[model samples]
Target: MARIAFIMLCHKDAPGVIAQARRLTASGDFVSIHFDGNSDPADFAEIWSALSDNPSVTFANRRYRCGWGEWSLVAATLEAVRAAVAAFPNASHFYMLSGDCLPVKTAEYAHDFLDSNDCDYIEHNDFFASDWIKTGLKEERLIYRYWFNERTQPKLYYASLAIQQKLMLTREVPSDLQVMIGSQWWCLRRQTIEKVLAFCDSRRDVMRFFATTWIPDETFFQTIVPHVVPRNELRNRTLTYLIFTDYGMPVTFYNDQYDLLLRQDYIFARKISAEALELRERLGALWADEGSIFRPRTRGRGFSAS
Candidate 1:
């Protein structure tokens, strides 16, 4: 069986995070958690107390005050990955997840699925090649520097963005590197993660440029992995299921969606609330019977690029 390391980025909802962690715990699978520095540690006291005795669980020592659209999120994730790698040397695959994320399948099913495939499961798309211009803020995100907090200084943010656009001070990504954007969640092989970390260490210029870019977490891994791994080695699909609202925020799952969620092939689902008692109970019951739901399914050796 393949040993898996789950790197979870959590901000709030202690009970929910603990429940998700418990569901994913197995003999050979390790969980590495990074709680946002901005969140009060008191909120997570129960979680730490519960998992402190579990040898399989490890917490990131270098935590970050992560902000939306900031590089801090990516930094925290890297810290979790580093801590996990150090703690679980035998881990074959590393999965990035959020506190709200819950396993839709059993731990045994997840291990078997990963063990059966060699390709990295990640979702990505070429930003310039796609109709990203339709999103309106694509140029602003790619060209101008958004170092300041948009929420605190909305006028200054827009003024700076406008000046950069009017002055045509648009910056180009490194000529050799292709810009890839995607969902933040992914599962990568141990070798792939090591290669990506090495690339980051050697390429300080690329890292510095992306530091001021909007939502760097969504692009950092997506951009670096393609350069390190061959196209045939990538699955180009995230195994987690998320429903987006018109405003682009992920919709929280409820008890009513239990049957619908179970019908999907995704191994996990996200953005569930800790207080959702009915949904939590239903999901718990489903997890107990996932062995029957996820019977061994055969496939070809490699994955095709999307």
Candidate 2:
């Protein structure tokens, strides 16, 4: 049996978080959570209580005060990963998820799929890719320093952003390191995860450079993991579904979208709200009925060290 460690980063929606965790819990799967430090303890009391009795569930003692497009998000995720790795040393794989994320496939299917495939499932694109940089979004994110203060007033925040854009205080990222950006959510093999954590521990310079970069969570892992692991061992696809809106926020799934989610090839879907109880129940029923067999679209050789 393949053991899986789920490293989840959560801020709010206690019920949804618990529901997602409960769905993935199995004899060989462990759930490790890191609640945002900014969130009140009282707000997460329900979550703590729900998982406290479960031996397979663990919580990070030190949480990061996460903010959008800030390094804190990366910090919180790394904390969860480290905690999970420590608690479940025998786990074969580690899946990074958010509180709003729910498994589309059953736990048995996940394990079987991982058992059959050895590549790391992560989505990434080179930072200098024309599509990502055409609008200067990549340049602004990787070059210019962004000072993000979550508590800043809207007007002041815009004003500071405008000034930063005008000044364009660009910094040079290390020439040896290739910058990559992608979805933060991913499923990595245990060996890959261990190598990534080791690389981060030794590379303080790389860490400091990304500390002030916008959305470091999207770049940090993608940038470093490729360097540490063989390119062939990396499958440039994340097994999670995310739909972005014109407003830039992900569209939350509701009961009406249940059919759409089931049709997706992804193993998981995100932004499922607690209020979508009917959808949750329907998915749970499907999970109960599904067989343990997992059929991958394609199979490759097991991962090899670089």
Candidate 3:
């Protein structure tokens, strides 16, 4: 009963969403989700009912208008994390994710690997300190939600540029006021999460200040994690990166790329087709059918990600 929380933000991608839930449950791991409020309740309800019997499923009640770089995403995700943290305070770590993500390995393997390592797989550092987004134009950024109504969502992203090009029109930034940016997904230790929440509370002003910034989610999580982890704990590079062109984080494997993915050192790749004859698909499906996920790449590890 190693506790692992899955934070999924979903809207219209029903097939992918259901497939992912099925796979995770099959793996016998715990998962929690944050569905977009902008989505269809009926559709969500159907999916929820299908998954309701799974002891691992915990759904979030709050929703926000998530945009590319607004604080809404950070705020919403933090809220979800807070809920999961409180409910399963003793869980070892929280693994971040979106609903469309397809795992490259067995879920059980991934969970067991993390369970064994006991390391936080987040990449936070001063590495991107000088990036354009963090250079003192703090008032225009925000976070990106997993899904959105383009009209409302686009404007959230626009605020950043509007503030930059039309508002201040200055390119210069001061050293102390610099902002940071990086990947939004991570696997964080329980203690690390507390620190991030504390930082959010202390920097309510900072979080509030970036509510309208260009893309706060990328920077919000990126910046804060680096600050909280023990100096030696963070990897400086993310354990999680986009899988592929899957706007939902696609990891492209042509019918031919299967063998290569299995041989790679990475744990989660975007996804292989839910139905295919390729090794990964066959293996993933086989493993998935047996109730496994993110497991190691041994020939015996049952299934692959969707």
Candidate 4:
């Protein structure tokens, strides 16, 4: 039996998150969630109460006011992964997910895939060489410090960038470390995670450097993962099928896209709309059905996402 531990970084949609947790637990997988400290207290309570009875579910003790493009997102993820590690040491893999993500494939299918691969499934591309980044600072994201949240404090964020550019104040990524960037969602093997966490404990300075780097959540793990795992053992791909618009926003899956979502080959699809109740309900039914494994009707087709 291949047991998986899901480390979810969630900020909103209590009911939707609860449903996701329940579905994973029902499939005999463990879930560790880090509810954002800035989220509604009532929503967190509701999620906790609903899944309290399940022994497979756990919540991270450390919470942060997670913000997009801030270090807090990485901090929350670290807490969630730590909680999952402490609770389920024997789990074969630790999968990182978001509250808005939904499983597009059956649990059994994913388990079998992981069991056979015996390697990490994380999207990692050379930061300076990759053209995947659509907008914002590229190599400069690592070279400068970002003290303000880009989304919430736009004026301050841009002002800080301008000051740094004017003053030519910059930092360097450690020569030994190869900077990599990719989608935050990943499914990593247990041993890979153990090595990565051990590295973090030993290299406090590296963590400190990334603390002010723009969107550390995307680069922190991506850079460290390669250092721990060999290139041959890494699959530079994400299991979650997520598409971003030209403006760098995820395309939300709606309730009416039932057939489209069902045909997806990936294990999960992200940024599902909160209003997509019908889609969630239908997917819930599929997850609960244990008679047969769900297969994609379409082949050689996948969503165009980085």
By lDDT, the best candidate is 4
lDDT for each residue of candidate 1 in 1-306, tens digit (9 for 90 to 100):
888899999998887777767766744578999988888888668789988688888989888988888888889999999999888888899999998777677676777788888989887788778652335577467777887667667797788888887998888787888888888899999999999989989999898888888888878898899989998999877888776654565678776877666666677788666777788777765654644665324221122232
Could you tally the backbone clashes for each prediction? 0, 0, 37, 0
lDDT of each: 0.80, 0.78, 0.59, 0.86
Residues 209-277, candidate 4: write the lDDT tens digits.
Answer: 999999888889999999989999999988887877656767889988877877876788887888888
Reference-based lDDT, residue 2, model 4:
80
RMSD of 3: 6.7
Task: List CA RMSD, all candidates.
Answer: 4.7, 5.9, 6.7, 2.3
Model 2 global lDDT (CA atoms, 0 to 1): 0.78
Q: Identify the superior model by TM-score, candidate 1 or candidate 3.
A: 1
Q: List the residue pairs that clash in candidate 1.
A: none
**Regions of candidate 4 where Cα sits further than 4 Å from its true position:** 291-306
lDDT of 1 at 148: 69
Quote model 4's TM-score: 0.94
Task: Supply the TM-score for candidate 1.
Answer: 0.90
TM-score of 2: 0.87
Candidate 2 worst ten-residue window by lDDT: 297-306
Output the worst ten-in-a-row residue range by lDDT, candidate 1: 297-306
